[model samples]
Target: MIDASLPEKLKEKISSFSDYKIFTHKNPDGDALGSVLALKRILEFENKSSEIFVFNSIGAHFYFLPGIEEIRIQKEFKDGANSPALFVLVDCASWGRTGFPFFDFAKKEVIAIDHHPKRTDKEPLALEIIDLSASSAAEIIFALARELNWKIDPEISFCLLAGILSDTGAFKHSNTTPKALKAVSALMKNGVNIKKIADNLFRKNEFPGQLKLLGEVLARASLEPRIRMAFSFAADKDMKRHGAEEEDLSGLANLLSGIPESRFSMLLIETGAGKIKASLRSETHKGVDVSKIARLFGGGGHKLAAGFEIEGKIEERFEMIKEKIAKESASWRI
Candidate 1:
C-alpha cells in the first residue's frame, strides 16, 4: 500500500511535469536499474519525456533487461539541454551517489525514491519516498504504479521481476516478505518467464577466471572461531593473477557466509592503489547487523547485507575491519 501522506503529493508533482531526468547510483545493481527503467517506461506511457543518466556502464549481465539500451552515460547528459522539470533519483541513497555533478543542476526539483535507510552523512533534496521495509526499490515502484493506476506490460513486469529476484536473492534472502512474493505473483500474471529470468540472472555463463577467483578466495578464507566470522581478501595482484575484474568479487561474501560455523562473513577487495571495497553478509537468524559495521566505515545497507569503501594499506584495512567486527561481536549473546 502507498503511504497516505506522500502519494497525493507525488501524484500532483508527477502530473505537473512533462519532462524528467532519472538517475540511479553508480555501479548500479539489478534493483537500481530495474526501478529506473520501470519508472521511465511508465512515464513514457503517459506521453511524458524521460531519460536515464548513469555514471557507469551497465553490466553485461543486465543487457537482458528491457530499456537497458536507453541508459545514458554521465558524459552524454547535459544539465541545461533538456531543462527537465523533475529529476527522479531512483534506488540511490544520496545525490553524490549518482556520481554526476548534480549541483550543476540544483535548480531542478528532485524526487528521491529509495528502499535503503537514509544516510546520516548527506541530506538529499526534494520530496522523499523511502521505505526500508520494501525488498527492493522496484517493489516500491510497483506499489507506486498501482497507486497511479499505470498499465503494466510484459516488459515492465520483466524488469520489476528482475529487480525483485536479484535483490531478494531469488527470494531466499531475509528481505523476502509476503508483500514481496505477492508483487512477484502479480508480475508473473503478466506472463513474465520466471525461469528464464532466474536462469539469465543466476546461471549466466561466468568466465573461467571468475571461477578460479572464487576458488582462490575460498582457499584463502580465514575464520575467527570465537566470533564465528569468516573473511577473505582479493588484492589487485590477486585479481591480476586470476585474470579477474572487480565484478568477479560479487557474491564472494555470500559464498563464505554459507560456512556452517560462520555467523557472518566479509570480503575485502583492493579496488585501487590505496582503496578497498568491503562486502559484508550475515546469517539472518544470527542477529548480526553488518550494516552497523558498514556505517562505521561511511557506508550503509540492510542488516543482513551491506558494503563500504575505505582507503589504506590492504593489511591495515583488514586488521581494522577485524578489530571492529570483533568489538561488535563481543557484545552478541550468540
Candidate 2:
C-alpha cells in the first residue's frame, strides 16, 4: 500500500519556502551525492533557491555529475538571520548523520528523505519520506517527482541514475527490484549514459595508490573460519604510505564480501585522530543484517551494508567487536 500523503506533504512543505538547504551524510557516497544533486536540480525547476552542504570532500569519480562543483564543504553551521529556508536531509534521517550538530538558532522546518529503515530515535523532523523497500534514495526521489507532477529533465535523470546505479552496484546487488529497473528504463529514455556512469563508479579507482591500498587491505585481512567472516583494518600510516584517500577505501568491504566462503566482511580505517571507521557487508541471501551490528556500535545503514565509527585506535577494541559479531551471527542458519 502506497502512502500518497507523504509526497503530497513534501510538495506542500517545499512550496512553503523559496530558499532551501540540502544535506547528506558525511563522506557522501554515490547515492548520497546523487540524491542531493538531483533534489537541488528539482528545486531549481520549481524556481526555488538551494545550496548543497557536505561535511567531507567527495571523490573525483563523482565529479562527472552535473553541478558537482557547487557543493559547499561546510565546516560548521553558520545560521544567520536570513530569510526562511527549508532544510532537506536527503539519504539520511538526522542532522547528526550529516556530521554536524542540529543548530537550534532558529525555528525552521526540516524534511528527511531516505531509503534506509526508519530509526526509532530519529530527530523531530516529521515531513519524512522514508521507504525501506526502495532500492535507493534516488528511487524515492524519482517517485516524489512523479507524484508532484514535475518534469524529469536530463540533468535530473543523470543524477538519479547515478545514485541508483551506485546503490544497486550496476543492478548487481540484491536490492535491485522491478521498480529500480523501471526507473533505469525511464532514465535511459532520458538519454543517461549507463556506460559512463559504470566506468566512473567501478573502474576509475585503478590507480597506483588505490592498488597499493588494496594490497595492504588484502594482505592484512583475516578470515574467521568459525563465522565464515573476513575482517581487516587500515590505519593512518597505511593510508599515508599508500597515498590513499578515504574514497579509495570505499569498496574495500565489498571486495572482502566477494570471498566465496565468507558470509560477512568488515573493514576498519582510521579516519581521524583516535577515530576509527568500520564498514560492514554481507550478502542478502546470507540473511545477515549488518545494520543491526552497526546499531550496536552507534551507527546504522541497510541490511546488506552498514557502518559505524568509534573514537579509538583500530586495534583498541577490535577483539571486542569480533566477539559482538560472533554473538550476533550465532543465530544465523548459515
Best by lDDT: 2
Q: What is the TM-score of each predicted model, taking all chains together?
A: 0.92, 0.93
lDDT of 2 by residue, 24-104 (tens): 988787899999999998999899999999985777778998899999987787666555888888998887888876676
lDDT of candidate model 2 versus the reference: 0.84
Error at 8, model 2, angstroms: 1.3
Task: Give the Å error, residue 13, model 1.
Answer: 1.3
Q: Distance from true position, residue 296, model 2, in Å?
A: 1.0
Error of 2 at 200 (Å): 2.0
lDDT of each residue in 1-334, candidate 1, tens digit only: 4477787788888899998889998888889888899999988888889989889677788888888898987544557654757888899767777867546544668888889887843454668898988999999999888877987888899999999999998998878999999999999999999898788778756688888888888899988886778888898888888788887778889989888888888888996557898898988777888888788788888888988888875777777777776786576643
Candidate 1 residue pairs in backbone clash: none
All-Cα superposition RMSD per candidate: 2.3, 2.0
